[model samples]
Target: MSVPAADRGATTVAERAVRRIAERAATEALPPGEVLAARGAAAVRGRRARVSVAVTLPYPTVLDDAGERVRSHVADRTAGLTGLVVPSARVRVRALRVREPKQGAEAAAPVARAGRGRSGAGRPWSQRRVPAAVSAFGCAAVCGAFLYDVVRVHAVGRPPARWRARLMEWLVTHGPDSGVWPGLVSAGAVFLLGVWLLVLALTPGRRRLLPMAAPAEGVRAVLDRRAVSALLRDAVAEVPGITRVRVRVGRRGARVRARLGFGGLESARRAVTEACEEALGACGLARPSRLRARVRTDPLWRAPTPPGANTGSGPAGSPASPSPTPDATTATTATTATTATTATTQGSSRA
Candidate 1:
């Protein structure tokens, strides 16, 4: 096998890096000294990138103008930092605020931005944010404690806090083997935590949303896996023979299963594949998903006939035409079968 020239010198940018760059760019794009907060998410393929940014704006700012600046700046900064061709950035105005208002105190109402993180693809840090935020909070708490103690001792000449005194006393009295079982348990916990963090760092996060190419200028978006599945099913339903469809979308591709109601099995299978592929293309994913469609004819289900189709007795003495099958759309509404036969009749025929 030979590697392509582009693959030979590939430079892969991390999703986390792109997110930070976008967040910084959004903040910088806003008015000087007016930034509240900005968070971003990104999906990058080769040298092309798609990004989503969510930000808080100060009260009484023109939303359209702020969004425009953010979109342009993020696109520019990401391109500059990672050398990626960013077609567009999806900027979401998450809120309007200089500071969060207290309960019962009226402030400028926060703006609503449609959420995109349900599938975790549009989250600022994917799955890493929670762990990273927790670690940062722990460190900040320690720093805050020291800062408070320093300020108190220097400015007011107060004695050390009782909490700190108790902690020191405990450390002095507690030896490594003081609580044998507890010490071993704590050691094991710390080791497990270290290993988990290491694994998280080495592995890529899973995303349940597909990145979409921008349909319009300066506007990229992502579609959730559920939405993709629903779209594929709807598309398959429109096919001539498809009675039911189940679509599963994963990181690698999409798997589709279709039930053919009444048609040549092979032809229906081909139709299903074509329908799914066409609908997927319309989905606008940055990397079009690999598609696999499986089709089977179902004996229990039937496709509905056209509204004007004739159902009549055969010409002359020919057998009467069978009644047309019930409409699929109306079948579910049926409460029970209408036919019932109970009689003492008995017939024996020899052929």
Candidate 2:
């Protein structure tokens, strides 16, 4: 079927209007929404049009509420700009932003300040002022202490403060403990702390959010490993006989560690592995990961007690009852009598 030029133009206009609306809604800074990608399509039938939009939000949002908001904005904008009655407006959230720890002031300050123009006014003075103040205070304290110590030592020809003298003495005498083991342990701890801090300072922690192959051109999507792990965990846990599950989602595959309670271990393992694979398949990940299931028998697991059963009692009040007659005493007496009879028979034979 061939479409008329006028109809094609109208559809283009409608799609463009919807796209603009989505960009505006997603870029708004007030509610902290950032649309990493957006797409829109419009269908024009005579005087009526239908618009559909899909957006990837690079942050966590209430999907239902955000979708509704986008739909409303797209419908209104499309109708106003294209002069077509929009009968349907649909919005889908393609991906959620990976949750990451907030970057320190050093990294976030520039980003926050650069967007001031688009954000209307800059953030309140309080937000920008605290970090600067803290830095200034630290510098001032260091310089002031240095000056005080220099003045006390040279200008006034006086001893340093008692605390300062004590600190110096401790550093000179006790700072390096005499024991080699203690020194090694201290050095190792300090080295590890420095390495940890260096890593944190040099690396952007949010890089763990792996980018997924986009379903559409000009669009990008990322999935959080932690979120995927949670999804797999829930799925594996639903399988019968799986009492607990832990899932670690990685770039290549997902590792599932499950505890089986009172069931065939092999069967439980197979069930959980199948369940996890199915769940990951449904997740629509760009690269489907292999499922590695490890099932362990929970030694402490016990069957659920029946409603009215008394678990505290044994079959009898006592676990075991002894015979009333003392068998050990009777046996000892018989042995003693036998020995006496043997001795008497020996004496008779001798006589």
Candidate 3:
């Protein structure tokens, strides 16, 4: 005889299956052409599930609206497919893509703007993974220790935990009327620590990584300051008169110092400055750098004229003549050089 349906075992849905359902739902919520990919994870306990979905979206779209659409769709679809109550659906927009405008239709393309007041230019923060993991671990350890201590003291008929015993003794002995200075000092230290944590939580921490413009709206773009410095070095090296190049990149701007090989001091300085600016611009930084761009020249050690170019170096056009020696005083005045050494910095700020 066959068993009745009532006596049969309950059906179960695997967590992976729930996750796939959520991912499918999230993908379906957006236009097929626009979405690059979608992924999801689900946690199930008893008959309830919590889902999180990650998706790529177009730039300039209202993040809130896009997120909500994905969230609602995932919740409804998961619940309907598995009969599992979905209490929460988290949607993360991984990136924003800027669609290229069709040729000859550039005028019709819409400008991408950062939503709200946020500079769509990304703030590369150290996600606080360490702090969060430490916090969670701390909480778990404390709770477990407390539970173990309780069990040993009550059920097992063992002495209380030493740590707990000491803590209790301290609390019992230290009444409300403790030393004012000690309590006040401790309170002040705690307050300062809390304020410091709050500051870290609210501020973006990766100062060295600068925001850059991406092809897509609010597109995530970043360039390292050290990398920028290297590029500046290469750019200055390319200029004809520069023998040695040094570059320093900071938050405000980049400072470049180039040594002249044979060209006019003023001309070499100008060329170095131009190279620095051009290279910096090409780096595509969203904001300007923090340091100023500067160039310093040492005319005392002009490189020996190349044998090939020296054919006419003798008095300006004699074949096989001696090269005219470089005179520091004959070049631009030190006053002029000093005046032109510093280049004003502008515009490297966080988005």
Candidate 4:
């Protein structure tokens, strides 16, 4: 026997409703693979319907609460879209995804531009100034000491100490006989030191800031290297199986170091590399940079605890307890007062 056209249409509607519900459930805050493993079905009897869904989360999720949220959202969306009244939804977490290291690179040129304000161009003054001042002071002190020794010799008209006379006589005899190698090496060392000091004094002591594409015609955008590094670190850390992330943002390239917790190292490397690349693209740097990702497996790895999550006693996935509710009598009294005030204001406005 052939099915009625009305019955066939109803079946098609139910199937679409199930698919839409499953799609919505998988997309919220969860990664791509987690949702792809999800399956959902809907059955309609008269105007009422039931939704059944199963999903596999990549990480440990509070099974009870997460399931409840997904079930509720699915039912609501299905009911609204289809004209069916969804009474209940059944949701189950089939499996937890294995944490594997993922690595990828983003292609973006980092902005390389001069920084404004106090520290600009080169190394900071705090690092270079102290060393330069100390060198200058030491050179002046040595020169002063040598001048005093010469003046003392002229005034005394004879050697102040016999050792000084011996040293001078030794220098006078051996200095000519000594090879030029010793003198050349000493002179070269001194010249290099002087050049270093000069460079330190002249160069700016600031980190290079990465440039970004200008937002407007007359405006310029720049991001600090430290900020870029922090952004990449956080992005890489979000990938599944990654325990720790370290990022170094330079003018020409970015280096990402990721530590894995479990699963295949190759998968983890690919995931992490892709994540880093996405983050770099989002950063919107003007100059494209090479991305170098290194993934290392850490057998003893432990994921960092999120802030505000209790480690001591509460059930997994349960949020902290809310504050106590206000007294019913107080709430009623406040509502009454507000209503009366609004009534009086309306009466006065009419007058």
Q: In the order shown, what is each candidate's alpha-carbon RMSD?
A: 26.0, 18.3, 22.6, 32.4
Please estimate how well model 1 matches the true structure, expressed as its whole-model Cα lDDT: 0.75
Worst 10-residue stretch by lDDT in candidate 2? 117-126
Error of 2 at 24 (Å): 22
- Which candidate order results from sorting by TM-score in descending order? 3, 4, 1, 2
TM-score, model 1 to reference: 0.38
- Residue-level lDDT of model 2, residues 203-292, one tens digit each, is 535544645544333445667788888888888878888888887777678798999887676778788878887888777665557778
Off by over 4 Å in 2: 1-144, 151-158, 174-190, 206-222, 237-253, 258-268, 281-290, 295-351
Which tens-of-lDDT digit does each residue in 1-351 have in candidate 4?
999887776434656556666557545535555444365776767787777777766554676776666677767777777767888777777777654434321112112222232122222233665786898799899788666777888987755656567767766655545655655566678889889878876765454677666432345567788888998999888888888888888877999998888667777888888988898899877666799999998978555655786754568788766654678668988999999999999999999
Listed in order, each prediction's TM-score against the native is 0.38, 0.36, 0.48, 0.38
After TM-score superposition, the amount by which residue 121's alpha carbon in candidate 3 deviates from its true location, in angstroms, is: 1.5
Can you list the residue pairs that collide in candidate 2? Answer: none
lDDT of 4: 0.70
Q: Over the stretch 1-351, how does candidate 1's per-residue lDDT look in tens digits?
A: 998897787678998999888888888987665664466789988879899888888766788887798789889988899999999999888888854445543321111111232232231235688888897899899999988987998899999888878877765555356766655676678789889888877765546766665433344477788998999999889988777888898976999988888866777888888888888988867665899999987877565666865557578656666765678535644523322111222222221
Model 2 C-alpha lDDT versus the unseen true structure = 0.67
> After superposing candidate 3, which stretches have Cα over 4 Å from the reference?
1-100, 103-118, 124-126, 168-193, 302-351
CA lDDT, candidate 1, residue 3: 86
The lDDT values for all models are: 0.75, 0.67, 0.75, 0.70
